[model samples]
Target: MNALAPNLIAFGRVLRRAGLPVGPAEALGAAEALGHVPFSDREAFRAALRATMVHRRDHFEVFDAAFDLFWRNPDLPIRPPDPDEQPPDTFPAATRRASEAMLGASQPRSSAGEPERRQDAALTVSDNELLQSLDFEAMSAEQLSEAKREIRRLVLPLSERPTRRFRSDTTGPRIDLRATLRGSMRLGGEIASIARRRQITRPPPLVLLCDVSGSMARYAQILLHFMHAVANDRARVHSFVFGTRLTNITRALRNRDPEVAFQAVSHILPDWSGGTRIGEALDRFNRLWARRVLGQGAVVLLITDGLDRSGAEGLSEAAERLSHSCRRLIWLNPLLRFAGFQPRAAGIRALLPHVHEHRQVHNLNSLRALVATLSADGRSHRRSA
Candidate 1:
């Protein structure tokens, strides 16, 4: 008989409700992955679920919560809680100590005369500890305000990649015959070196389409900090806000300090907490702003909830046109953080077909992932039914 594992499918549902994009495929993946993990330890189980179930940054905390709730051993005898009692952030300190002692009962040493640090470190990731403990969903209004300030300080700065320049050693199919012949004149007509035309690498243009509509208010504020970081550090990054209308605030967010840039953006963006008209916004961007920003390997990041009040056909056409204008068109939608998410929304369905990469942007962890994804050239696999 197969041993009964924790109901991972039910756990996935909990994560989805908590804002993790864990769909049926990911649910199945998590189940299959759990088989490889030793289910004897809570930490091990947590690791397995995180690796298989969570993809985007924003969903990390939701996954953490679901894992914590799912792995609780209800069969263990315990006293009933007081009516006013609340659950602890984690297991009791005494329980944690006992668990640690049990896990650390055995130790291994390396042949190089060093104690192995691998086992303990794997179970306790510092980033996870820092981010997972903070409950973003239940934060008080004041705490949320402070969290936004913290986000501003740690966001990554965007730096330009060095471009290809003419080098003597690099062989190209098109040779400069005239230059090669001219050099050979000094060496008795022996063509040994050649001068070739080459292009200099310039910083790629950045175009950010940030959604500032009603549904995205909380995340939008946080993401503006990220945008400010990128805009201040990079010379060619353009920023635009969309709600009922599109407003280009690239100039406003170009201030040296992220705080100042965000302040300026706040002043200029009058449509905060308004309705989302993604199609109309994209239409404006394509018709008027595309040629201006879509130059020199530009990458466009479309940040929104994919909740369009506008019609689907308009969004599809506009998204398609926007995709064609950029080197890479990445859709950074916060809604993707939910588990069991599907492209069922009219807006989501229409826009997905045009995006080169549809990634999640919900928290600091996810933002860090975006940095890695952006710096590297590997393509993200898009799933389609």
Candidate 2:
């Protein structure tokens, strides 16, 4: 057991570098687990280490690749393969990343180290491109952390809506009678110059209604990071999470730090990762919050998978009311990521017609597309008016 300790510790470091959450504690746990299993049996050895080191479903692939490369060639150093040596698409993203980490550990230092570093940097850029399209449900702990950082930089630029109030403008289309008269009075009633004004325009309020049911657990967590960023970036942003019941989390998410805001949310939320009751939750929001937050032509973002537990009862009416109350009601469903997805579920059929736009919220690319859609919608509204 003492002889294998150094090898196990090095393997743990490779897993960590490959973006698994393995640490010294997990390494110790693996060592203890291996004691019970026969070391000579390769399959048993792999199983024991896996049980101790891997916790997340998404980490399994990377862990397996790292384990194979490290244990099979214990003494041999593996250098990164040249990009042209093999087609990049032949390897899975997890395998590719694991190979890179293992190579970084064993590659010998050379005088021409600058080129090697540049190649590693290029590989990193490639990894980020792949990450943008990766599903939130498939991301490992490290990837999810990186995704959160990317989410923070996302800007939700809503369309500017005209208000009844006016502001002074030099090239105004409409003359300001009140301001013109006031200015003439200052010139001894000579009517010297006409004052001008233009209608004031500002971004509309944003409302987020997220589902935190059992099936949507992973997506809800990632979307909350996005909601936190949006809430802090602008005013009049309201956020709510619902499962068996609705909870207003607008105030909780307003905290500057994302970690603190999520902690506050968890403390207040009682029905997270529970059963879904879309109809009842929407009804509650309509009665308790619609009048308060759905003012000033607000844009509503409803994030859910549309798997209702209550058989869609009263959901259509509630959705219709919500759509009418806001300037635009956008339904963001993760299920839409499937190419063959249909509104076969009762909840989806009930709510589909009520929404102005139905979009996917499963990946970072989808979220970026959403921002583009909103900006385009705002511009169209301005042109049409």
State which candidate has the highest lDDT: 2
Question: Best by TM-score, which number?
Answer: 2
In model 1, the runs with Cα more than 4 Å from the true position are 1-128, 132-193, 196-198, 379-385
RMSD of 1: 18.0
Error of 1 at 295 (Å): 2.2
Looking at model 2, how many pairs of residues clash? 0
TM-score of each: 0.58, 0.69
Worst 10 contiguous positions by lDDT, candidate 1: 97-106
Q: Write the per-residue lDDT of candidate 2 for residues 188-257, one digit (tens) a residue.
A: 8888888788999888899999999888876887899899999999998999999999999999999998
Q: Please, what are the lDDT tens digits per residue for candidate 1 over residues 1-385?
A: 0444446655665555443456788777877877887878778878878887776333344456445544574233233244467553344322322222222322244489677576567666674456633444334333444556666555443345446654343455456666788889999998777756444456578889999887887677567767887876667788999999899998888777654565567667778878899999999999999999897678888999899876554999998898888777888887777787788889999998888888877766677677777777544455442
Candidate 1, lDDT over the whole model: 0.68
What does the lDDT read for residue 292 in candidate 1?
90
Query: What TM-score does candidate 2 reach?
Result: 0.69
User: Residue 135 lDDT in model 2?
Assistant: 86
